[model samples]
Target chain A: MTIGADLKQCLATIKSIEAGLSSLAINTNAEDEQRLYHEQMMVIEEIKQDLMKRIGEVEREEEQYKGF
Target chain B: MPEWIHIIYRGVLFLILLFLMTKLLGKKQISQLSFFEYISGITIGSIAAEVIMGLDNNIWHGIIGVAIFAVIPFFVEILSLHNKKIRDVVEGKGTVLIKDGKLLEDNLKKEKYTTDEILQLLRGKDVFQVNEVEYAVLEADGKLSVLLKKDNRPLTRKDIDLPSINEKEPHTIIMDGEMIDDKLASAGKNRAWLKQELDKQNVTIENVFLGQVDSSGQLTLDLYDDKIQVPKPQEKPLLLANMKKCQADLELFALATDSEKAKRLYAANARKLQESMDVLSPHLKG
Candidate 1:
C-alpha cells in the first residue's frame, strides 16, 4: 500500500484506540486507573493528529504530481 | 535376631518397599485416585503396619503380603490403562447431577448426594445460584464440575476480540543470593548477559534475595533490603517513545523544508514510521 494509505490505516487504529481508552476511563471507578486511561487517550490523540496531517501532505503531493 | 531388631529391620524394609510402590503408582493426588487405587493404598498401609508390629518371626509372610498387594495394583493399573471397560469399572463414570439448570433427582439419589450437598459443592465452585449453572457433573473423584450458563459466564479476552498472548514460564535465575546456572541456561542467557543486566540496575547479586527472568527476557530482582525499590524495565515503552519522537521530528522537518520534494520525503517517511508504530503499539503501550 502507498504511504498515504498506510497513514490512513494508522489514523483509523489510533482513533479506535483513543475511543477505547476514553471508554475505559469512563467505565472505571478507580481514580488512578481513570487518570491513566485519560492520559493514554491524549497521547493517542496527538499521534492521530500527526498521522492525519501527514496523510493530507502525501495526498496533496500525489495530486500535484498528477498535474505534472 | 532379637524381637526389637527383627521389628526394626521389617519396619525399614516395608518403608522402602511402600515408598517404591507409591512411586510406581504415579504422582496423582489422593482426590484424583480411582476407587481401586484408594482401597489398595489403605490395604497396603494396614498390612505394612501389621507386619512391622507383629511379634511373629515370619518376616517372609509380611514381605509376600506387601508384594502381592503392590504387584496386583500395578497390574490392575496397567489393565485399566489399556482397556476402557476396566478403567470405567475402576473409575466410575461421572454422574450428571444437573443438566440445563435442572437437578437430576435420580442421578443425585444414585450418587447418594443431597440437594444441600450439591449446593455446597456448587458454592465451592463459586456458583451460588442453581439456574446460573448450565451443567454440573459429579466426577468419579467427587469433584463438582460446573458449567455456567452462557449469559452468566464471566467475559473473557476471546469474547471481546482481543488477541491471545501465550507467555512462557519465567525462570528463577537467582535464589538466596546464589546464581542458578542451569535456570539461566534454560532462559537462553549466560553469565555475561546476566552481569550486564545486573550492572544496568546497579544491583549486586548478593543483595538480590530472588531474581527472575520473565517471558520477555526482562530481569526482575527482589532485593534483600526492603527499603530499596528496583526500577521496572522500560525497554518497550522507551522504544515506543523514541519512535514517536522520530515521527514528530520528521513532521517538523517536513514543515521546515523549503523544497516540496524534501517535504514529501519527510512526510512519507513519517507516515511509514507511524505505520510501524501502529503494529507494535499493542505490545508496547501500557
Candidate 2:
C-alpha cells in the first residue's frame, strides 16, 4: 500500500513538473531556455516511466506473497 | 488480415474517433483532464483497441462501444460547463499556500506540501528566499502562482523613471537569401528598396543570411559568411581585463580558479563584440 501510494505521488509529481516545464517552454522569450526546458521534461518523463515499472514489480511481488 | 491493411484501418478508425470525441468535449478537455475524464480516456482507448483487433467479432459491438464511451464524457463535460458546483467537485479548487508573507500551514498540509517542496517551488521561480514572497497560490491544475514582496522584486525601467522598451515583435525581411514578400510589404519596403540597401552595404542578397526589421526601424543583417576581414578589437583582450578586475573585487566573489565565471565573462565580451561587429561590419569596405 505504501509503495502504491508512493508510486501515485511520483506519477503526480512527474505530471506536474512536465506541465510546468511545458508552460515555461511556451512562455519563455529565449529559444535556448525553451530547448533546455524541453530537454529537462524528457529526462523527467524517463525517470517517471522507470519508477512506474519498479512500482509494478513491487505490486507483482506482493500478489505472489499473498498467494503463498 | 494483412498487417498493412490492419494498420491502415486502425489509423482511420482512431482518427475518426479522436475527431468525434474532440468535437464533443471542447478543446480545453485535451489539456485539462479531470479524474472522470482521465478514466473515460482509458476506457475509450481500450474500447478503440478492442474494436481494431476484434475483426472476427461483430463490427456493431465495436461501433456501439465507441459511441457509448464517447457520448458519456461528451454529456458530462457539457453538464459540467452549465453547472458550477459539479465543475468544482470534478476539477478541484485552487489552494492558498502563502498570504501576507505568512505560510498557510493548514493549506500546505491539505495540499501535501512539505517546507522543502515549497522551497523547491519558490527556487524554480528564482525566488531563492522565502521571506521575499508576499503570496503564493497552488492552483487547481497543480501550478504555483507567486507574488513577491515589493522591495525584493527586480525594479523595472518604469520604476526607475525610464521609458518603456518597445515590445513589438520583430519581423524577418530576408531568411537564408530569400526575401519575405509579406514582411517587406508590412515594413513599407519594396524589392527595389532592399536592393538599394544591399548596394549601400556593398553586399549582394545572395550573401545575406538573415535580415530582421526591429521596432526601432533598423535593418539588422547577418551574413552567411561571417569572417571579419577588418582587424576589430579582439574580444579576448577585453574579457581578460574584465576577469582580472572582477577577481580583485571581494564583493563580486569571483575567483581566478572559477572556470565557470571565466567562461561567462568570456561569452559576455564575445557577445558585446559580436553586436558591435553586426552594426559596423557592413560599413567596412571589403
Candidate 3:
C-alpha cells in the first residue's frame, strides 16, 4: 500500500465505476435516455480526473519516501 | 296473436338489434361516455325495453325510435371528431373552480356547486386547505381535477436533477405458461432470449404464472407455486464503515510499530484502503 500502489488502486476503483456507467449508457437505446446516463458518466469522469490529479501529487511525494 | 308469442318475438328481435347497434358503436367504456353518449345510450335502451314489454305499441314504431336515438349519437360522435367547437358544445368545457388559490365564485355558482361541495372535492384530492390549491377544474363528467400549489406539490425527478428514467413500459413475456408473442415483440426480444433469462433464474415456463421484463432488463417471475426467494437488501454504508474501521486500525499499528519496514507495509495498506474509501464516499452520499 505504498503511495504508488494506493494511487493505482484508486485509479482502478474509479475506472470500474466509469465502466459501469458506460455500460448503462450503451444498453439504453433511446437518444434521450443515453444522454441521461451519459450525464452520470460525466459526473463520474470528473471525479476520476480529480483523482488522477491527486495521484500525480502523491507520486511526487513518493520520491521522498522511495528509499524508506 | 298469442301474448306470449308477441313477447318472445319482440324480445329476441330487439336483443339482436341492440347487439348490432352497440357493436357498431366504438368500444368506449362507460367511464369514457360523454354527456350526449350517456343520454343516447339510455334513450336507445328505453325504446328497446318499451318494444319488448308494451303489447299494444307497434314494435316497428319502437324499432324506428331506437334506430333514430342510436343514429344521432353515432353521427354526433363522427361530427365531434372533425369539429373541436362541436365537441366542446356536445361534451361541455371544463369549468375552472379554483385558479391561483382563489375560488372562482361566478363559475362555481354557474355550475350550481356550493362552497361546501367545492371544499369537499378539494379535500378528496388530499388538499385539506383552500390555500394549497393552485387550480381546480370541474370536468364535464362531474369529476374534479385539482392541482396543488407549487410549494405544496410532491417533488419530481427534475426538481432534484435526477436522470430521466427509461420510458419503455414493462412487457409481459409469459402468462399462464404461455408466451405472449405481442408483448415480446413490443419489447424487441425473441423467445430464445426469454428462455435464456428463464433458465438463468432456473424457472421453467410451465411453472411461471406470470413473467415480465422491464426496460432495465430486470426479469420478474411469478410462479404458480407460492414459494419464492426474495433477495436480501445489501448492508451498504455499514459494510463501508467496518472496512474504514479496519483501515484505521492498520494506520494505528503502522504508527505504533518500531520496525521501519513493517511500518511502511502497514501504512501503505492503510493508504490504499483510505483511497478506496475516499473514492466510495460520494457514491454513498448520492
Candidate 4:
C-alpha cells in the first residue's frame, strides 16, 4: 500500500514537471532554448510513460503479496 | 587682369571643374585602375596644376583637356560593362604565370616578369615552394592570385564534412554610452528588454562603451570603466549545468531510495535525462 502511494506521488510530480517544461518550450523566444525545452519535455514524457508502466507493475506485485 | 587675380579665379574654376570631373570618373582605388585610367589620371592632374598656378597661357585649353580625359574614361567604363572584348582591352587579361606547379616562362616573359619576380609574388601570397602552386595568375590590377595544390591547401570545415550553419552577423546595439535605437529593432529587441539585460549585469547604459547582441540572443557589453569587472554572460552554460545537476540528483535519489520500484523509476528517468543532455550538448555549448 505504501509503495503504491509513493509511486502515485512520483507520477503527479513528473506530470507537473512535464507541464512546466511544455510551458517553457512554448513561451521562449530563443530558438535554441525552445528546442532544448521541447526536447527535455519529450524526455520527461518518456520517463512519465515508463513510470506509469512501473506503477502498474508495482500495483500488481502488491496484489500478489496481498493474496499471500 | 592682375596675375594674382588670374591665379585666384583660375584656382576656383579649376577646383569646381576638378570636383565635377572626379564625380563623373567614379570611385576606383588608384591601385585598381587600368593602364589607360592611370595615365589619364596623371595627365588630368598635370593640366589642373598648370592652370591652377596660372602657368598655362590658355586656361580654356587646360579645361578642355581635363574634360576630354574624364569624359573618355566615363564612356569607356560604360562600354566595358556591356562588351566583354572592350573590358578585356581596357582592363587587360590576367597572365597565367604558373600552371600545374610548372612555371610558364613564355607567359611570364610576355608580361615582362622574371622568374625572381614570380617567386617574389608567390612568396607575397605565403606560398614558399614553387611546386606547391597549382595555378598563379598575374591579375590585370598587377596583383598576383595563387591557387595551391590540393595537397598543400588548408583544411576547412567542408573538407572534413562538418555541418555548416548560416549565422547572422551580430548587431551593435549600443555604442559610446548611447542606445542605437535603429539597430535594436534589427536585433528584434526593444528598449525595455535591453534595460532588463543591463539590470542583470548591474551596469547602467551610461557606463557601457559597447554592446552587441549575437545570433543566439546573448548580450555582451564592454564598459568604459574596465576596472569594474562585469560578469561574463554564461547563461547557456549555467542552464546546461543546472539540467545536468538535476539529472545527477535523480541518480542520487535512486541510490538513496529503499523501495525497489521507486529506485527503478528514478534510475530510468536519470538515463532519459542523460540521453536528452547528449543530444542538446552542441546547441547548449554553442
Candidate 5:
C-alpha cells in the first residue's frame, strides 16, 4: 500500500480499537489491562504522528514531480 | 464424413473463436503475460486443436471446454482489477533477487531461477557486473527490473545542473485533411484558428495530412506533399522550477529539524539548483 493509504487504514484500525477499548468493562483489579490499553493508545498516537509526517514528505515529493 | 468439409468448418470456427477468446483475455505483451495466462493459452489451444480434429467426437464439448477456459480468465482479470490481493495471488508477486548489490539466495531459490539465468537477464539489461546493481527484482510477469547503483545509472539534467523545459502532451488537431474538432476544442482552439495557422504556412487544411499542437501552444503541421523540419535543441532544458521547489522544501524541513545532516543535504541541493539555473540563464536570456 502507498504511505497515504496505509496511514488512512492505520487510523481506521486505531479508531476501531479505541472504541473497543472504551467498551471493555474494568474493575479495580483490572489496572494491568487498563495500563496496557493506555500504552497501546500512546503507541497509536505516535504512529499517527509519524504517518502524518511521512505523508507530508510524500506530498512534497509529488509536488516536485508535477508539470512534466 | 469428408475431411475437407471438417477442415474448412473447423478452420473458420477456430479463427473466430480464437480471436474472440484472445480479445476477451485483453492485450498483454508476450513478456508481460503471467505464468497463469501462458498455461491457459496452452490449454485453450489444445482444446481448439481438438475441436478442429475431432470429427468423430462431439464438437459442442470442445467448444464448451474452450469457452470455460476463456470465461475463467475473463472473470479473473476483472477480479484482479478490483481486488489487489486477488491480483497478487492470481498474477503472483515480484520477488527481490538482489538488494544493495547483494544476491538474495533464498529469493532466487524460491523463484526457481538459476544464477546463470539471472546473470543472463542482467546482461540483457546491459548490466555487466552484479556489484553495479542496487536492486534487481524478478517481476510477476517473469521479466527482470534492475535498479543500478549511482555510478552505473544514467546521468540526468539534475546531476549536471541543467534547466529543463516543462513537458506537454501533444494533441492531434487534424488527421488526413479532416479537422478533429474535439481535439482542437480540447486544446482550446477552433477550426477558424486552425485554418488561420495553416494560412501562415502558405497551405490550406485540405492539403495538410496531420497537424498537432503541444501544451506550449506550438503547432506542428505535416503536409501531404511537404516534409516538416523540426530542429533539435542543443541542450535539453530541465524544469528548474521543480528543483527550486524541492530545494525550498528541504530548506524548510532542515530548519524544522535543526539536524546538521539535513542542513548539509539541503545546502547541497540548494547549490545544485543554483548551478542548474546558472547553466540555463544564458539560453533563457537569448
Candidate 6:
C-alpha cells in the first residue's frame, strides 16, 4: 500500500485500540481493569511499530526509485 | 527409630491423609460445611491423631479408618452434584440478609448473625451507612455481597451525560536516561524525531528521567530530577515555544492539497507535536 493508505490503516487501528481500552476501563472490576488496559495498550504499541516500519520501507523505496 | 523421626513421620502422614480426604469431599464441603461434615472433620482429626500416636499402631487399621472417612464424603459430593435436592440439603440456599434496605430479621435469626455482624460486613465493602444498601445477601461461604442504592453509587461519566471519549494506555518511551526503541516505534515515533523534539525543549536525550507517549499522540517528558516547577506567565513564551513550532508544522503539512497525502502528513506531524508537548507542557504551567 501507499504511505497514505498505510497511515490510514494505522490511524484506524489506533482508534479501535482506544475504544477497546475505554470500554475495558469502564466495564471491568476495579481490581482487574488496570491489567486489561495495560494489555490493550501493548497491542496499540505493536500497531504503531508496524506502521513506522511500513512508512520507513515506503520512504526507502521512494528514495531508490528517485536514484538519490 | 528416633522419637522425633517417628513424630515427624506420623504428623506428615496425618496431614497427607487429611488433605486427601478434604479433596475427595469436594469444594462445597469446605464452603458450606454442613453440621455432619463439620463434626466429622473434627472427629476425623482426633481419630487420626490417636492412630498416629500408635493407639491403633497397625498401619492397616489406620488406612481402613481413613478409607472409610474419605469414601463417604467422596460419594456424598458426587451424589450432591447429580441431585438438586441432595445439593440443597448439603450446601443450603443463599439467605437474604437485607431486602429493599430493610434487615430481614427472620433470615438473620436463622443464619445466627446479629445486626452488628451484618453492619460489620457492610463496612468491609466500604458501605458504612446502612441507608446506602439496596440488597445484601449472606452467601453460603459466610461472606456478604451488597448492592448499593442507586443514589449512593458514584456517578460515572456516562451517568453524568459526559461525552464518551476513547482512552488509551500511555507508552513509556524513555526510562533512566535510556531510549526505549520499542516504545518509540509503538508510539509511531522515530529516534531522529524524538531527539529533535527533546532538543526543542532544551532537554538532551541523555537527561530525560522519564518520557511517555499516550494514545492521543501526546508526549510527556520529565527531566532528570527536575521537580515540576510551574513556569510563570512571563516564562510561558519560552516554555510554549514548541507549541508554535507544532502549529507551524501542521500549517506547512496542510499545504498538501491531495486528501490522502494531507491526512498522512497531518497524522505524522500531530504525533510529532504531541511528543514535544508531552515533554514541554508541564513547565508551561497551563
Greater lDDT among 1 and 3 belongs to: 1
Question: Considering only N, C-alpha and C atoms within 3 Å, which residue pairs clash in candidate 1?
Answer: none
Among these predictions, the greatest TM-score belongs to 4
- For B85-189, candidate 2 gives per-residue lDDT tens digits of 988887777888989998999999988999999999989899888788999988776778899999988998678865333334668999999999999877656
DockQ of the two-chain complex in candidate 5: 0.01
lDDT of each: 0.76, 0.63, 0.72, 0.79, 0.65, 0.64
lDDT of model 5, residue B127: 91
- Candidates' interface RMSDs, in order? 12.0, 15.7, 8.8, 4.9, 25.5, 13.4
How would you encode candidate 6's per-residue C-alpha lDDT over B158-269 as one tens digit per residue?
A: 8876544445567899998999999887666789877876765667767778887655444578777567442222323442453455344444445543557645755665
- Model 2 docking grade: incorrect
Candidate 4 Cα misplacement greater than 4 A, ranges: A1-68, B1-20, B29-33, B57-59, B243-286
Can you give the lDDT of residue A41 in candidate 4? 84
User: Model 1, range B37-138, lDDT digits (tens) per residue?
Assistant: 677777888888998898664778877877887788788878988999989998778899999999999999999999899999999999999999999999
Q: Which stretches of candidate 3 lie over 4 Å from their true place?
A: A1-68, B1-15, B27-29, B230-286
Least accurate 10 contiguous residues by lDDT in model 1 chain B:
B28-37
Chain B only, TM-score of each candidate:
0.82, 0.61, 0.74, 0.80, 0.71, 0.51
CA error at residue B170 for candidate 4, angstroms = 1.3
TM-score of chain A of each: 0.86, 0.79, 0.74, 0.86, 0.57, 0.54
DockQ of 4: 0.18
State TM-scores per candidate: 0.70, 0.51, 0.67, 0.72, 0.59, 0.46
| TM-score computed on alpha carbons, candidate 5 | 0.59
Show the colliding residue pairs in model 4: none
